[model samples]
Target: MLNRTSLLAAPALAAALLFSAPAAQAQISTPAASPKSTVTQRVGLTDITITYSRPSLKGRQAFGTLVPFGKRWRTGANQTTSIKFSDDVTVEGKKIPAGEYGIYTIPNKTEWLVVFNKSTKQGADVDGFKDDQDVARVSVKPYKLGNKVETFTIGFSDITPATANVDMMWELTGAKFKVTSEVEPKVMAQIDEKVIKNASPSANDLAAAAVYYYDNDKDLKQALAWMQKANATDPKFWNVHTEAKIRLKMKDYKGTVASAEQSKKLALDAKNADYVKMNEDLIVEAKKTGKL
Candidate 1:
C-alpha cells in the first residue's frame, strides 16, 4: 500500500545507494603500481618490442664488478633478448637475412662478442644456441662506464640520414653493429646520374662509376673508358691500375701486363698490402701467358 510517488522515489534511492557504495570504496583503495621500464625499437626493417624489470643498485655493483667478467649474460631479464630485421643484412661478416632473432652476448675485459640466435623460445640459454640457426656473430670493443647506470640501455649512434650504428651496452659488456640501407639498382642509377650531372668529375667518382658499370652491368668498353679517364684524372686510384687485370679475363694479355706494371708502381708508392699482392699475382699470370 505505497503511493506511486513513493515507489518511484524508492527505486531512485536504491540506484543511487548502489552506485555510491562502489564510489566510496574506490576512493579509499590505492591504485595499482606502474611498470619499471619498457623498450621498443625497430631493427632494420622489423619492429622490436620488449618489456623488462629493472634491477636495483643497492649494494650491488653492475657489470665488471659484482657481475664478474668473462661470462655470458642473458642480455636482459624476464624474457629472452629479441631483435627483428625488416630486410636481409650482414652481421659481423656473416649473412643474416631479413627476419627476427634473439640477441645474446659473451663478455670479456677486452671485447664482447654479440650473438644473433634464430630462436625465440623463452628461458633458452647460450648452450641452446644452434650453429646452423645462427645468423651472425660480431665482436665489439667495450669502454668503461664513467657514470653509474642503474638500468640497461640500448641505442643507436653515428646516425647519418642514410645509415646508423646500433649500440648495445649493459652491465660490463657491450657491442655495436653498423647498418647500411639496401639501395636498389634503379635508385643507385638515379643517384649516379644526379651526382654526375651536378658536380665536376674527379678521379674518385669516375673510378667508382667505372667499377660499378664493369662489375654490375659488365659494360667492358664503358669500364675501359672510365678507367682511362680515372688514370688521366688521377693516376693514384688503384683500381685504374688494376683494370688491365680484368681485361685479361677477356684474353687481353698485353693489356693485363701493362695494367699490372701500373698497379705495381701505385701499390709500391701507396704501400698497400692487398694491392701489392694483387700486382704480384697479376705479374705471375702475365708471365705465364708470355705477355711479360
Candidate 2:
C-alpha cells in the first residue's frame, strides 16, 4: 500500500511542475497593457484601415536593431496590412480607384517607398508580391523623431475639418502622407444641379452637397443653410449632426457648441453611433474653448 501511494504521488507532482512552468513564464511576460495598435483613415472616397503589432526598442538598438533597414516590412504584423479606398484617388501621382490593397514598405533612414499592391493576401516579404498586382508606389521622405517611440504606431496628424496627415512610425523610420477629405466642387455642383433639376433633393443629396460646400468651398454660410434644410427635410437623417463639425471648422465656437449639443441629443434619441461620436468630439472641442 505504501509503495502504490508513493508511485501515484510522484506522477501528480511531475504533472503539476510541468503545468506551472508555462504559467510562470506567461505571467512574467504579460504586460499591464497590450502592445497592439490600429489606425483607420478615410482616403478620398475609400476607407483605409491598418492594424499592426507594435515592437519596442527596450534598450535594444532600433533601425537595424529591431527592424532592419532596406528590408520589406509587412508594415504591420499577423495579417497582411491592408488599405481600402472609398473612391479612386491619386497616390504618388498615380491614380488608384477605390479598392482594397496590401501595404508593404521598404524602410530606409533617409527615405521610404510606400507600395500599394493589389494583392491583399501577400505576406511581409517581396517573395510573394506579384509585379502585375502593383497599383502605385510612392517615395516618401523620412523625418527624424524627437522622442524614442517604443511601439509601432500610425495615426492622423495636422487634423482639420477638411484634411489631415497620415503618419507612420516604426523603429527610427517614419513617413507622412497628405489626405484630402473633400470631393471636387465641380462634382458636387453637378450632383446638386442634376438632383434639383430632375426631382426633389433627398437627404443624401443634401448631405453630400453640405459636405462639399463646407469642406471644399469653405463656405460656412452655404453649408449651414443646406444643413438646416436637410435637418428640416429629414430630422431623422443621421448625418445632420455632422454639421456641427463644419460649424467648428468655420470657427463659430458658439454655433458649434449649440449644434453639437443638439446633435448629441438627437443622436442619443436615434441610437446612431457615428453621429454620437461626432457630437461627442464636437462637444469636447466646445468645452476646450469654454463655449460648452
Candidate 3:
C-alpha cells in the first residue's frame, strides 16, 4: 500500500538527482597520456626485455628542456623503466649478471651515461636512488637524428649472433650502448658433446658441426672430413656447395671444382638457379690462374 505523496516524491527526487550530478566524471577506460610500452630481443641465447612508458613532446622540447641535460633521468615518464636479461651479459665490456634492473640516464650533447640501478620500484621517481647499488654503468656517445622523434623510445638495434645495442632515442638525439653475450663457449661445448664425442653422429649433426666450424674459422681439415662424411651419399646441393667452399678455402683446387660441378648438376636437376650460379662462380674461381 503506497501513499500518493510518497510516489510523487520518488519521481521528483529521481529528476533532481539526475539534474544535480557533477558535469565532470571519471571514465573507467581512458587512455593514458604516457602509455606503457614493452620491447624484447634475443642476442645469442639471451632474451633481453624492456618495459617503460612513452611520453610525447606535445610542442615542448625533449632533450635539455623537458628531460634536462646531464641530469639523471628516470629514462621515461611516470614509473621507472625496467630492463631484464635472461643470462649474464657484458654492457660496453662491463659485465652484469642476469636479472631485472631500473634504467637511469644522464643525457648530454656529445655523450650519455646509462645506468643500470639495482632498485626496481620506488615512488614513481628515481630521486631516491644511490650509485653504490648500480650494477653497471656505461658512457655511450650520442648521435643526432635528422627528423624529430616526438615520443621517447627504447629498442634493440645492430643485432648480430652474439651482440646487440640498446638504443634510446628522443627528439633529435639518439644514444646506444653495446651488449655482448658469451655464446661461443656455450655453443662450442654443446657441439663438442653432441657431435664430436658421440660415437655415431647423424648427417644433419655432422653437417651442422662442420658449418659452424667453417664459419668460426676452426681447423679446415676437420671441417672438410666431417663434410665429406655428411656428403658421402644422397647429398643435397646446398650441402655439396658448402663442401665446395671448404675445399676452396683449403686450396684443393681439383676437389673444389669436382664438388662444385656435382652441386651444379644437382641444383639444375632441382630447378634452383641460385645454387647453379653459386657453383659456377666457385668453379671459375678455382680455375683462375691455371691452378687446375
Best by TM-score: 3
Q: For model 1, what is the alpha-carbon lDDT of residue 185?
A: 52
1-292, model 2: which lDDT tens digit per residue? 5698899899899999999988877844565232566677754444656666666656677666555789877776555667766666666556777778877888787888788888877776657777688888888898978876676677877765445677887655678876565456546567658544646777777777777777665677877777777877775525556677777777778877778778778888878888778777777887787554
Question: Can you list the residue pairs that collide in candidate 1?
Answer: 45-86, 46-86, 88-98
Which regions of candidate 1 are displaced past 4 Å?
Answer: 1-56, 65-68, 122-131, 171-174, 184-186, 189-292
Model 2 shows how many backbone clashes? 6
Q: Assess candidate 2 and give its TM-score to the true structure.
A: 0.56
Which candidate leads the pack in lDDT?
A: 3
Q: In each prediction, how many residue pairs overlap at the backbone (N, C-alpha, C within less than 3 A)?
A: 3, 6, 0
Provide the lDDT at 182 for model 1: 52
Model 3's C-alpha root-mean-square deviation from the true structure amounts to 4.0
Give the residue spans of candidate 2 off by over 4 A: 1-36, 43-45, 160-163, 180-182, 185-195, 198-292
Query: lDDT scores for all predictions?
Result: 0.65, 0.71, 0.89
Q: Higher lDDT: candidate 1 or 3? A: 3
lDDT of 1 by residue, 1-292 (tens): 9999999899899999999997888756463232234455544333444434445445566676644567655566555567666666555556677777877677677887777878755344547656577667888888765555655666667754334666665554456777654544544575367445746667766777776666565667767776787787678627855587557766777888788888888888888888878877887887788645
Q: Rank the candidates by TM-score, best first.
A: 3, 2, 1
On the 0 to 100 scale, the lDDT of residue 178 in model 3 is: 94
